[model samples]
Target: MEDSETHNLKRETIEQQYKTVRERTSNFNSYTSGGSHVMEYGSTSIKAEKIYLYQGFDPASVNFPPNELSHDTQMEAINQRDADILFLWHMYKNSEDGSKKKEILKQISETMRHRIHLDGSIDLIGTVLYGPAKGSVILNTIREPGLPLVDDWQCLKSMVRLFETHCGSLTQYGMKHMRAFANICNSDVSQSAMEEACVAACSSSHDPTQWHPSNHGYSA
Candidate 1:
């Protein structure tokens, strides 16, 4: 699952909401398998694992959390390879340099493959996580490159629950954003129908809600 706006909340407001989640969600433990940023859930902090870099690039370095794990501990747990879900960050549309962005993604995928090999056999459920406006663009682009992305509506629903359960203390403006996502879920629209509307919007030179998956298909 993914959350956050590029620039919609005041620093204080963001911190307040984050504090609420950390204080309330004490039962949930957030982990960043290959991520190296600080993340906290309740009193627990899970740090992303640090992997040896490939030409100075760490594919798992998308961002991570509040806890730090020692290198020996991380290495010992390599056989555990505890991830079942993978959420990738950002989008090409948000990138100022598309070529470099694509290169980074390519390296990330390669590095992940290498890590998996070292970790032994495993299975993963992967999704491209991003904001709503760029959702459609990201889904299509990632699929065109043969990488499966989560469906837009599915993504919105996941995001809505994330906000309600974890970030409910957000400011009024931030709450409005969460409500907007909830509205999308309640719309009960299909991807094909939304795609048609998007095409119509483009024909009229208007942009509607911006922002699918692969043949592996969702068993749901």
Candidate 2:
């Protein structure tokens, strides 16, 4: 059911390509898609998991068979998780102390994407979502036909809060300086030296609420 309307597929591109199949040879031309969560042809209907041969799935293992149709929850979880991450990052970036902000930003992407499982375990793609990526309708985009309005956007504000707070300010613009920050971090400069450099260069703290770059000056 998921169609970006374009081929903007990601990690599960292959699986999503033909999530469900509809037999279309004789009598009834049935097509399967993630929406119905089943493969159908005329009168025949089968769960997506039932066709577990040569699709790269191990017959011994099963995904969330009981909740294949509810993967919208998983997508919601992803949005929430991303929002949480950005919140932490926003605080780190807006830290009053220059050295602390620089130190926190140096961690690699691996550390930034970390999440903990619901069962007290840890993994990058943790089980917190508690839903499988397969057999999802809105897993990537508007999978359900004409149901884009149904998408949960409660966290939309949280997702953009940081940007909104620093809009038109140098702090907002700092998001674009990712590579520059990375280069400085990798330049082997000592913490004291980096702080000194930031102090010398910025010379003032930014008030994210005020966007007069010329008047407020740059932030460290």
Candidate 3:
């Protein structure tokens, strides 16, 4: 028989271990070859190729023929851009106060929402973590591009926090993979390509900012 406290502690430890295993396995065993990115955990692999084009192309340069960008193109842009933003937001969190970090999280959430509206659903975990504040900001930003959702300085401040927290130790290979996915998003990459790109983004490295790079890959 175990005491209440010991039982609680055991439960907590098991929960933590379970969470770790889930995270490790979430994107595991999903991979694709002949593309720009590769995601591998243990013996599993997920390939993400769409992101490669998204990262490489300039959003402004894309011509949309008097209509909004296509779903694929938009997704590519959002994934690549979010990766950069996430990297920045993570950096800011590490150096700032809790209050400031919370504010940054709000902004990120808003931006993420805006990207989602444009590109459709994103990685569910990333969407949930960023929360409503950032989601609202994204809405406002898209509504009035030049009107200032939050102060530019505030946005920059948040980005710094993101970099510190998430993208601080990103490897060159990881960056390459991320950029590859971005490029794929920007190009006319196929569903398979997109899947491969997402997998690559996931497997290339683990960072807080890059939580969902591969989440939407399979959906495509």
The global C-alpha lDDT for each of the candidates, from Candidate 1 onward, is 0.33, 0.32, 0.34
> For this target, which candidate reaches the highest TM-score against the unseen true structure?
2
Give the per-residue lDDT of model 2 (tens digit) for 36-112.
Answer: 23442443222232233323434333332321333222121223325545766887867887877776675424233
Stretches of candidate 3 exceeding 4 Å from the true structure: 1-79, 120-220
Q: What are the candidates' C-alpha RMSDs?
A: 21.3, 20.9, 25.6
TM-score of 3: 0.20
Structural similarity to truth (TM-score) of each candidate:
0.18, 0.21, 0.20
lDDT minimum window of 10 residues, candidate 2: 116-125
Put down candidate 1 lDDT per residue, 62-125, tens digits, no spaces: 3533323222232112212222112222543355676877875774564354344312211110
- Candidate 3 displacement at residue 182 in angstroms: 19
Model 1 ranges off by over 4 Å: 1-23, 27-88, 91-93, 121-220
In the range 68-88, model 3's lDDT, one tens digit per residue, is 223222111224534656675
lDDT of 2: 0.32
